[model samples]
Target: MLVVAGAMAETSLVAFRGWPSEALEFYEGLTADNSKTYWTAHLTVYETQVREPMTELLAALEPEFGPGKIFRPYRDVRFSKDKSPYKTHLGAWLEAGGYIQLSADGLAAGSGMYQMASDQLDRYRRAVADDRAGRELTTVIEAIEQARIHVQGHGSLKTVPRGYPKDHPRLDLLRHKGLVTWQEWAPAAWLGTAAARNRIVDFLRTSRPLRRWLDENVGPSTVQR
Candidate 1:
């Protein structure tokens, strides 16, 4: 939905009512028949029910979080063994640093560097090893957890990386290859309403401390993937 107040377009905002139930149904069908035939048959459903609402939501969120880019629905099967042609979910990344996804499982929101380059990993380990920065991170993670959001370490090592020993105080932090704060909500009635946006907004706001820690300490990876 759009509103035009006058000839001079003062504001052009697309209304985001949230994803309809059809969006989930589309994914459910795709999960069963993951082929071009299924996608081609349901292209209308994908564009209107899934993609449009997501674009509106991103637009609404951009005022505070900066621009958000939706991920391509097609899966990259070049290196993968499964070889699925399409992704099971729709996701977007906010430039300010956050993520949102919708799928058959429901909605998920997260913010962090999912994977780090070697240099970034090295910096992350060093920060975690330092008593002051490490303790601060621990506190941040604890608070986020208490809020019922999980802080995850992507590709965490079974043992603390190569150094810092078995008796290291911040062993758990050092083992993390990447850090992210994530929250998931199972499918429900609220998913088809604006409440969905509210939930993601809360998650992005709650992750501020964690984002600050990473930005101030680890920063971005210098090594190109």
Candidate 2:
């Protein structure tokens, strides 16, 4: 989202017709040359072709999924060893839930918490230890994976945490610091059509039970970040 001086005004919202082929190609070029020159030279294409369509998609999805915000494409290189200037993909998160990204590889969508905090992890472990909540979560994850989406944990402990039995039936859940469901589609003809939005909507809807389970059981962090 680099805006040059005197660039044309922001593009108004339109019904999401899906991204054009050029949008993916823009990221391809950025991946090769992640410098100011590449970004400045192609800002027009990024704005009109890539950013505008993303905005439209977010607008179209507002009613059912709530609002969405696109993440800025610039990379925060101040603390990283690699100083690449820009992100290679466009990503956005819905206000209610779910994430979407478009890049040279493909379109991808995800739902559920990516990571849990200390207090949240405590709650997660307690709920996961309970037979009722644990079994409910197991059913939700199974249904999601059965629909062909991938569900997995992140930052998992090698063994059970303190006070949890190592032989616990839901050891996978107990070890997790986070849980999420993901789906990806390689670059395809449907990507440049409304089918892209439909796919994302379906994935989000299908994985919603997982989000609901976590919200009801684990909730959010009490300790501030």
Candidate 3:
């Protein structure tokens, strides 16, 4: 049962029924035919078969991880050259700092900063340079990787930033522009079962130490979003 305590009366908790097989099929079809006519014809399937289950999954995650906002299906084509009509995947972000996505390829979850503003990057570099904090982060990253999940940065400088020692002990840390934890689940039988949610919950839980390290050492950007 996908019951979140205090969410509502006991009777109101929605049991998460995993995404149906048709959810992937819908995306597969959309990928091939992204025309508005195709979307209009299949709109009902997208809502009932794909969106509903995802909404339930997010609701279930809300009790522990906080509320999540689903991404709008409409694509922003004004600035893009490709000008695709819709996104190939569905995505959402939780207020508590987590992301989820579903598509024909698979489901994915991620957390941590994808990219930091200039000010935040400066602070992050300072923390990474701190001997004790840097070592602690190394341990956290190692543990997460040992669990078979990936820990990586958004973009890394070819070399250490200026003013940082060329031979610094945490050389790799100083080169990072941003840091994040990510995991993906390719289409599988388990994905259609509650195990999908379990795997995500496990990944997020395992990555908690890394998130905590960031919170303590490199918090939210002081710069406006």
Candidate 4:
């Protein structure tokens, strides 16, 4: 189960890196490993129990976002020192909104669903504010905030766990990147339910249209060059 889930998670990472075929192959190999029969069995459980339905929801969302493009795996490290060889998962670009990460482990554990961190959301908002894109970031942010609120209000009972040191690297990086601000809502729990997942998919569909709109209204910014 973990192997399959991990493969699925890797698929998303690979997709994010723009290698769908490789991601698919990786998943297939992981499932075909006969030595780990129990893992395969567990994989079946998750696929039947979780993956299929999520795939359906994503399919229903296809028209709104158009076709998703896989990003290339090669890292353009001309300017960076830490150059890894390749990205390990597959990601789908949402036309109107943010992106989705798909991984086997993430899927199996239910955490690999949809993730758009506050900082990433904030970057999008800032881009819009800076006229880097056509659609307003505020609009998207408001919609996501509303969705989050809706999820929290009507969905699960999970709360943010405490006790992490204040100097945690992940938290620090998030703050440094301006992805999230330090506030009461800094570590809000994202509801993990089928309904919440559907809402996220819907949001991504709307968000994807930004690509076309941006190309027409704002053009690519200097940073893109």
Best-fitting candidate, measured by lDDT?
Answer: 1
Mind sharing the TM-score for model 3?
0.92
Q: What lDDT tens digits, residue by residue, belong to model 3 across residues 1-225?
A: 346555555535466667888999999999999879988999998998788878888888998889999999989999999777988898988877888999999999998888889888888899888888889989999999999999988799999999899999989888999898999888989888778889888988888888888877788777866
Superposition error at 79 for model 4 (Å): 4.5
lDDT ranking, best first? 1, 2, 3, 4
The residue ranges of model 2 lying beyond 4 angstroms of the native Cα positions read 1-13
User: Scored by CA lDDT, what does every candidate get?
Assistant: 0.92, 0.91, 0.87, 0.37
Off by over 4 Å in 3: 1-13
Q: In candidate 4, where is summed lDDT lowest over 10 consecutive residues?
A: 180-189
Candidate 3 backbone collisions, by pair:
none
lDDT of 4: 0.37
User: What are the per-model C-alpha RMSD values against the true structure?
Assistant: 2.5, 6.1, 3.3, 15.3
Q: Who is ahead in lDDT, 2 or 4?
A: 2
The positional error of residue 208 in candidate 4, measured at the CA in angstroms, is 7.6
Steric clashes per prediction: 0, 0, 0, 36
Q: What TM-score, over all chains together, does every model reach?
A: 0.94, 0.93, 0.92, 0.33
Error of 1 at 223 (Å): 1.8
* lDDT value, residue 141 of candidate 4: 37
What does candidate 2's lDDT look like per residue over 40-121, in tens digits? 9999999999999898999878999999999999899899999998999999999888999999998999999899999989
Model 1: pairs clashing at backbone N, Cα or C within 3 Å: none
Task: Say which prediction, candidate 1 or candidate 3, comes out ahead on lDDT.
Answer: 1
